[model samples]
Target: MGRWAVATERRRGEALIRAIHEAVLAEVVDAGLGQLTMEGIARRAATAKTVLYRRWATPFELLIDALGEAYPVEVPTPAADNLRTDLIAALTLLTDWMVTPAATAVMAITSERGRYPELAEALWDKVFDPRGGTFTTTVLRWYAARGRLDPARLTPITTQIGEALVFKLAIDNARTPSAEEVAAIVDEALLPALGL
Candidate 1:
């Protein structure tokens, strides 16, 4: 028999992108931002470097794109009547996402933002900003628009309360907050600030 090359099925469309995203996140979490590279991601993803290049010019660009895709969006109650429940759910989403590889990669980028200012900027611009700014911002806005929350109270600081507390507790405790802790944050901290 003549020697022949073996062919394997290739990932395409959303599946391919999802694999690439997961690879980049794992790369950043495992190797850190300084060590992230197209070669590294492609190797982790089991794809060709040419495949990554076909979509992104730099490793950071691909990383940003991946982060944007992995980032979560909060879904508040449609009627906007359950502010506390919705806020708890919003903060719960944050806590849930905190344990993911993508969230770990985000922490890596943010912790080293001073060293990688451009990367941090891209994270904010490309990922967080486009995704409703913060965890509770969307829910808060939803309530305010429905007249459940006062619009004037939805300042930057107020909108950040849930996310800030969640991050602070995570940093201090060395773990993501639990469901009760998430609810406490909304009740004890966020609601008071919003004048609930």
Candidate 2:
């Protein structure tokens, strides 16, 4: 292909991907994940079904990508000078996202993981862990830098305690955790576990 043809193809590919993403979000919101299909998304996005097939082997893959884009979480570096306060702030961001429509959709999609094993792995690999890692990794390293992180509790599971609590509350209680509850999770559970 010529240089101009290659550039044009790249631009069109970008536009098609964007359109597919938007179409997936619309399909999820309108029809729910169970009902989403490549044909429907292609029609919604005004693109060829072959285009989607070329990129994603299944609707689950497309759904994961769409969820990643639709529910972009901002991981804030908490600078509260103490693990408790910093963790509370960081955990609050996750707690807040837990109650959003996007999260609800994610929960719905994940619940069907029994049917689509790949969806379960993709949701964690593409959507949750990547965003969750940003906060957990940053906070752990920040505390470690100050020689505050307990060497025994320096694993991924330990870093996830606060967000895990928030997720549990969101799932079990069907409500966003209160500020006090968020703080309590950080201070009472996570801090103690971390030996902080």
Residue 40 in candidate 1 has what lDDT? 98
- Which lDDT tens digits does candidate 1 get at residues 7-85? 4667789999999999999999899999999999999999999999999999999999999988999999899989999
Q: Which residue pairs in model 1 clash with each other?
A: none
TM-score of every candidate relative to the true structure: 0.94, 0.70
Count residue pairs with overlapping backbones in model 2: 0
Candidate 2 residues lying further than 4 Å off, grouped into runs, are: 1-19, 43-57, 71-80, 129-138
Worst 10 residues of 1 by lDDT: 1-10
How high is the CA lDDT of each candidate model?
Answer: 0.92, 0.74
| Alpha-carbon RMSD, each predicted model | 2.7, 5.9
